[model samples]
Target: MTQATLSADRSDANANANAGAAAGALRRIGAHLAPWLAPLAILLAWEFAARSGVLSTRVLPEPLAVVKAAWSLIQSGEMWADVKVSTWRAVSGFTIGGGIGLVLGLATGLFKPAEIALDSTVQMVRNIPALAMIPLVILWFGIEEQAKVFLVALGVFFPIYVNTFHGVRSVDANLGRARKARRRRRPARHPHHVSGRASAAVEERAAKRDARPRPQCPRRCARRAR
Candidate 1:
């Protein structure tokens, strides 16, 4: 074969391989999507059946009827007012609560003494449901909007704090080893495996006496960092 024909043959093989990989991925996605599709299809069928009176709209409203109810609520100014009030409360609470969680998480991640002292208790308390706290929050802050905000803020705090605390307490034991290794060799590279292994090996070996021994290092170095 001519060199160009050989190259074209290799490209066609690569294209076929890529096509097979894509087909495999598409099949997996379709498998995952199948279960969800059944209920969705049923809902559409129900909606069409209800509108046509194969099912009675009188007994159960057609999908469009439900939409009309929702649309009418939207058309009326009252729905917007309620929405605005709820949005205001949720935004205020989410912002304040999420901020507190992030700060506490960062603090906990950074400090070991803080993590050991506080995290066990925090984890234990996180099991308590937020709904259970609503009564206590109301008692402390009253039925005012502040009560909701307080409840949400407390709800947001502990888990984030513990996660942050643990993150800060761990890692960096391998940093020096990594730095020294950079002077000798990288992990055994598979140059023939990549695009340009031949030229790279020639250039690297020609200049250096790869005569230096690589330092003794353990694969488990990352374990010590924590």
Candidate 2:
């Protein structure tokens, strides 16, 4: 081929390769972004529909109005206070209830005799819905904040108690057996996995040996085989 012609062909090939790479990259980006497209389209449609009077503007305010109201609440600091108080209540209840449940559950769960003794009563209490107990709780603890906290704790305790009791009672025997087997196998553990690798090395060595011709078998064994 002529030098200039060869150079022109190489430049054409390089340009095609760059274009193909760019197309591949664009396809990958589209694949990654595909999931968000439907949600964004729906949101846009909903906003336009609400604004265009196809939907009730009062009930389904435009996204802009919702954003404005949220911004106003934030500027006035009501949103922050509300978030703080609610978060405090939730975290307090979770900590108190979760701790109480874990301790009681572990006690009942770890002991079979205790499980038999306490399981029925706890299960009965759990069957009664928390909302139903509100009246009784109000009468006993009043409407003070402690009443709410106690209710939250009680709400979390029963499921943990019953589940823990049953879990300990019904644990698999094979797990214990497996633990014992592991203890027995602890020695020479290196040999277990390494044996396979060692066998692979031996096979490779045998392949190398077989590649070359070997001396013939002894006459007596060869005759018997024949």
Candidate 3:
């Protein structure tokens, strides 16, 4: 083939490859954005309805209006103050609830007597809705920060308790057997060493449970290879 013809063919091939790459990138972008399409459409419809007077501002304000109000609150420092108070209440509640739950869960999971005494009561309380206690909470704590904190604590308590109890209970039976065997072999060994080993095993199990495999993007991988 002539050199000019060969060069022309090479340029055409390069252009085709570039176009294919741009198309692939667009497809990937569209795929990523697909999940947001419905929400975006809804927002657009809401905005159009509000502007067209189909929806009353009194009943439902425009999204832009809400954004503006939030911005105003932020500028006035009211938003940050409210956020600080709310964060404090939530953290206080979670700390109080989570501490009790962890201690009780460990006790009940490890000792049969503690389980028999506490588990039934805890299960019964867990079945009761947090809303059910609202009247009593109001009467006892009144309309103060304490009431809000108590409600938060009540909401936080059960999940922590249940998860901790189950996690401790779910420790491998083989590990427990191994611990016992080790104690029998070495009668003079410190008890803390065995307990530390058990704790390590629990931590390892939790780490494994929380370790998730990240998904690879094919486009990114192909680009990296090139």
Candidate 4:
């Protein structure tokens, strides 16, 4: 082929590739945005209804008004102060509750005696709704920050504990059996050495399984807490 013709063909190929890439990127963007379309439409309708006086501002203010109010709060620094307090409460509660839940879950899941002693009591407490305790909580803590923190902690505790317990229990029994068999076969090695290695492997597998449910726990806890 002539050099000019070859160059022209190369340019056409590059253009086609770029077009294809652009189209694919647009498709991906559309896919990501598809879920927001309904919410966006609803917001538009809400705004129209409020402006046209079909909806009462007292019942549900227009989106623009809410945005303006939020902006005003932000400018006044009140929004950030509230956010800081809320964030601290959530973090402190999550840390305290999640930490204890994880430890107790691990203990119960790993040891038969611990499970026997604690699981029934934990389950009983878990059955009681957090909302039902609100009256008692008010009476005890009197609307103080400690009451709020305790409520948040109580809300966060169970999901983490239940998920962790189930995750540990879900670890394959065959894996544990295989490790035991390997330890038995290694009779020449010191008993503690072989057993220690086996236990570590088993615990590692359990730990991985335990992590799988954790991302889900936060969502569940947050919904309940709210």
lDDT values, one for every candidate: 0.76, 0.83, 0.94, 0.94
Q: Which ten residues in a row have the lowest lDDT in candidate 1?
A: 184-193
Give lDDT tens digits, candidate 2, residues 1-226.
Answer: 9999999999999999999999999999999999999989988998999988998987888887899999999999999998897777677777887776676678777776766787678778888978899999999989987787778778767666667666775888799899999988886586877998999999999999989987666997889989
Which lDDT tens digits does candidate 3 get at residues 81-154? 99999999999999988888999999999999999999999999999877899999999999999999998888
Worst 10 residues of 2 by lDDT: 160-169
Q: Provide the global lDDT of candidate 4 against the true structure.
A: 0.94
Q: Each prediction's TM-score against the native?
A: 0.49, 0.55, 0.75, 0.69
Candidate 3 clash pair list: none
Using TM-score as the measure, which candidate wins? 3
Residues 1-226 of candidate 1 have per-residue lDDT tens digits of 7999999999999999999999999999999999999889888998999978899888877777788888898998778998898888778877887787777667656666756776677777788888888878778888988987676667657656656556655657577688777754554455545647777888789768676676765756767766
**Candidate 1's TM-score:** 0.49
RMSD of 1: 20.4
Clashing pairs in 2: none
lDDT of 2: 0.83
Instruction: Provide the RMSD of all predictions against the true structure, rounded to 1 decimal.
Output: 20.4, 12.4, 22.8, 25.6
